[model samples]
Target: MCKQSGTPLQDDLFLEETPTSSVTEKVAKPGPAVELKGSVFTLPVLRLKRSDLGAIEEALSERISQSKKFFENAPVVLDLEHLETPAEVLDFAALCSLLRTLQLVPVGVRQGSAEQQLAAVEAGLAVLRGGSVQETVAAESKDKKTGEVVKQVVVPSKALVIDQPVRSGQQIYAQGGDLIVLAPVNAGAEVIADGNIHIYAPLRGRALAGVLGDASARIIVQSMEAELVSIAGHYQIFEERLPDELFGKSAQVYLQEMALTLVPLR
Candidate 1:
């Protein structure tokens, strides 16, 4: 037998007793299809000290030769603010092509001149924030009495706290903030921060603080067995076993006159 329209089924109660609006109200709504939020990641930055393409290519090749697997296919951001005003405009497309041919992905650029910015966009690269030179954006405001326009820059602060172990191949980055780890950072892991990194357990992999050139940033480890440590782009790699006294001991890493320095915490 068929039920008539507007009639409830034998096993249903809401459709018979509840009004349409009330029945609909009792049903759950569908969740949103997407969400938006802020996030950060640590990435390699290539600070351009010169505009010569030949030199840049040669240097990149040499650097990658020393650590091919480490840099292979990794996304690198070009820092253009450090580049001097060139006699000629940079060829961003060609440069990006070169990077691709060398197995490196050129994804974005930062701190570029207006011309460079346009060129980079044309070359399919994004303009990312947090460049070593893109630390601030100036907002112009007129002084009330003087009627003079003034530029103001503001910086935000934050901190990332992790309560569990950082396993191998895991990367933790605290962009524009500090990173605090309550557990061990195992081999092949990396921890980076723009401000500072505090590890309450052993650091067996890499710890790079002041990643965006904050020279005063530091790394404090409860037990240091790091394969590599860096501060403000200055780095040290332990090719051999660490000295017995320094291994498995508390230590702090910082920059001294632009050089990476590590010392005992006690």
Candidate 2:
């Protein structure tokens, strides 16, 4: 008769097997990778002059009522530099609350002093510095024979081209220039340009042009089926299907008189 034991015996030698260590397969966790890259973004700067909460709220309410669509969920930077005095007391928390009431999200505070910055932090706001606000200048040249220097006029950045389709959750932004997508922009994707946006294929996602407050920015799409279109700070959403003649056809979007205008791209 075989002896009974708590551990199993080895099949070949018929000897009791020693305890073995457990092995596990390594798995990669699903999370966003940490990467450092250069980027540029446009933010509406609300220049505040007075700390009067009542007046500010009233004024903001009036403005919002006029064009609630444009300001909906808009992120704005508080510019305290325009205040009468740098040391002037400001209730940042109250001001932020007032802005939220008007559908404007206050993301950061710019041009504030030490005290004001501290106040902004307490209000859960970021302190941002002035970004590059100037246009790109071309290379200067000098006349070899005349020994005279010639300055060339500044030119906007060259257009960025995307040859592949923009998948959902993908974002492409052209800073200080135009963006041209040769492939379709799937729904839930975003494409932004500071100058203009040109889509050679269907545009079913959101497209924002003139992100840096360029009023002349325009959007041209081969297929007019965008979920949302925006120029400068003006925006228009397409809740329903586009017109039969306009859908899946060439169209252009622009801003006129601080309003978004869409027309056929002829």
Candidate 3:
């Protein structure tokens, strides 16, 4: 009743298929983990000539008037490089006063002679080129050493402070220790800290913490809802819209388990 199909060959000639798991195992594996890095903020330098104090003030005032929105709370570095004249001719205090009027904080002086450096130091402003001074001091100490005794020189860490509110378009930076802000940071403002950023008032602007690659650094703000928050180069932008509940609230931002988290401050 059944049409005889072709004679069935009994000898086996079939080859088994290779397992897919073996192919997957032969593929390259992932490389080592990567460490995230942070960013640092440097103030803009404003240079002036030795005999151009009046012009310096005028130019600075004009700049402030034109970009007042931009330099509201920005810190500035006064470059006295062109002011190579005698220290007696320079009115450091008056210059500082002028800067204060423009809402620019002059933290340090750069490119000055030894006498200028001395005056700056006496005026409570840190000397920018203190590295050479420190190195020379260290070398002298080594030369004075006679026996196997080595002098241990410890340079105490200095703290920088900002006692004013940070407005929009302004920026504040701390080089070493913690950065303490006693005022509110408005939108568009930027605050950077090498160690930690502690904002005593509301912070609606950008705040960067753990600058200089400090993963352990943290940002503490009285009020959150920041335009942008960054830590160790990782950043988050609230462009579309910030949560309504987060507005006008105290919060803390930090890196936890390689992720950025914003938590309400208790």
Candidate 4:
């Protein structure tokens, strides 16, 4: 029997067995060898603050022990902003192997210096670009040769919308934009967006916003009963139940001082 397993939307794969070939049967024509599409995903980022592999292993073990299921086989991106200056020496292969042994998948590295990026590529990781916060400003610039004033504009994608209730096991994503749901989000479902997530109905599942590192993104819900919620990778899980003051009430989830903050929407 063929075995297939993965998350609902991110990596779900379908397979089927091929029938026995026979001369009497019509000749089978070959199909495309592979297909590719562009998609946006929200993955956890592991920022490296130090270059000590021993210390990193110890701290990583402790942190993963606290949330085993959440980190199991989860893809992650390395934040190498700290490794730029002084060019800290890093063992990409060793670090990646360690992450794998801990049941984590290191898919890519972002914001790395030239040498670090080369090292990551040698270690079979993608060199990604969008891990830093972005700013939208109407600023003036001068042409290099002519010294002429020029204007630059930043355009943002429109928010993706769902007009009906999101069922369990369903995953919705709003790439480069916000997300809006007109109905309830059932448990076991997930809604993700690169910007804010606005729900006109109750939220009972997981909602991840600001997946691209927008710290100002927020999740606004009509009724808040979410099992988990995250903004800019800072997350809060409701193990048992929410406090009486916030359970099933209109609420807003945002990031404050690099921490996840929840407040009533009164």
- Top TM-score prediction, candidate number: 4
lDDT of 2: 0.84
Query: What lDDT does candidate 1 reach at residue 42?
Result: 57
TM-score of 4: 0.79
- By lDDT, rank the candidates, best first: 4, 2, 1, 3
**Please, what are the lDDT tens digits per residue for candidate 4 over residues 8-35?**
4445554545667776867889999999
| Residue 227 alpha-carbon offset, candidate 3, angstroms | 0.9
lDDT of each: 0.82, 0.84, 0.70, 0.87
lDDT of candidate 2 over 1-266, digit per residue (tens): 97666554665444556788798878988887787897655566787888888888888888777657767999999988779777986888888888887889999988778999998999899998753234443557898899788888767889999999999988999977999999999998999988899999999998998776678889999998988898875777676788887899999999878888889877
Q: If the candidates were sorted by their TM-score against the true structure, best first, what order would they fall in?
A: 4, 1, 2, 3
RMSD in order of candidates: 8.3, 6.7, 24.9, 15.3
Candidate 3 TM-score over all chains jointly: 0.42
Model 1 earns a TM-score of 0.69
Q: Candidate 1, residues 86-182: lDDT per residue as tens digits? A: 4335888889888888899988988767788888898889988654532434588999999999888756477899999999989988877899999
Q: Write the per-residue lDDT of candidate 3 for residues 20-136, one digit (tens) a residue.
A: 564445678888689788644544566666556678778878767764665787777666666656454466788888788778888888777778777777777877652111221
| Stretches of model 4 off by over 4 angstroms after superposition | 1-26, 84-86, 137-155
TM-score versus the correct structure, for each prediction: 0.69, 0.62, 0.42, 0.79
lDDT of 1 at 226: 92
- Residue pairs that clash (backbone atoms under 3 angstroms), model 2: none
